[model samples]
Target: MLRSRDDKKTQRQKSEVWPMAKAHVYQRDHINTDEIIPARYLNTDKEAELAKHCMEDLDAGFVKKAKAGDVIVAGDDFGCGSSREHAVWAIRGAKVQTVIARSFARIFYRNAINCGFYLIESADAVDKIKDGDEIEIDYDAGVIKDETSKTKIQFMPLPDFALEIIRDGGLLDHIMKTSA
Candidate 1:
């Protein structure tokens, strides 16, 4: 749900608000996992170091200030590269909770879920959403609201099963819970 600017102001004025510290806007399609976290970093077994280089080209300073629960808004084909699970691992390792994009590479999408990363797709949502926009995503409602723009964007809702898996931390955890 993308909210209008006025709506965002209203929301902020009402109470405590968390604003995005950084925003990365990409113009191209098919930004693969390599771009998100370069292959060279893969040599290191530690995710902490690997995530430090994530999206180095896109945002060199991201690793320094990015917290565990930051949100990433990207354009079409956001994760279109290799089938490396390390890519997903690095993102999760960085502690990013959600990724909103126009479209995603099939493998990347599934890999993200398997690693407990929430991925949402919204065609024009990325365009309308700017960097640092105080936004709220309602996973159950399939909406992304931009408090700054006061714009609301609708996205495809995650299937209940998928949500369940994510809610449980990942497929492995989900399986363990059900098996028990």
Candidate 2:
């Protein structure tokens, strides 16, 4: 099948690398899914609607402060609690490019990747990165650079399969591409 020029251009746009993102520091641990997106907002799975309330209970100013390419900096045990996919969806819908944490709840980690959301686990980086710091992440290079502090933190690179899934925009899209 041949794609039109516009279709190819659209595909190219989708594959473009993300730019450096700003960080919003939430230096607390054990931030549960419910806190990320309250149960009251759980009535809908619509990302746009859910995004309006993401982190409202925990940080009332989050929605107002968030920008399309902002990153979330959090402490250990981020996204703990119920296995709700809405938690990740809301964050993505808010246009947050990625999340950096000392650690993440196992289920949340997996769910995040499944939704094509980026998450990095590095205890050292989380502590050093201040609120509203500018940061750049190079997944291929496995480096997280804090522009504000002029420091670099290294994290274990994602496995090849995981990277492939992420690059292709989530597990479902990756699977569909391979299947066809």
Best by TM-score: 2
TM-score of candidate 1 to 2 decimals? 0.78
TM-scores for every predicted model: 0.78, 0.86
User: Would you list the C-alpha lDDT of every candidate in the order shown?
Assistant: 0.68, 0.79
Model 2: per-residue Cα lDDT over 1-180, one tens digit each: 321112222122224445667899998999999899999988788777888998888998898988877889899899999899889878877877778898999999999776666678888888788998888787667787888889988887666776777777777888999999
True-structure lDDT of candidate 1:
0.68
- Candidate 1 Cα outliers beyond 4 Å, as residue runs: 1-23, 65-68
| Cα-based RMSD of candidate 2 | 5.1
Candidate 2 stretches with Cα past 4 Å from truth are: 1-20
RMSD of 1: 9.2
Q: Write the per-residue lDDT of candidate 1 for residues 59-151, one digit (tens) a residue.
A: 778767677456777878888888887676666566665677888889999987765566888777778878776676666677777877888
Best-fitting candidate, measured by lDDT? 2
lDDT for 94 in candidate 1 is: 66
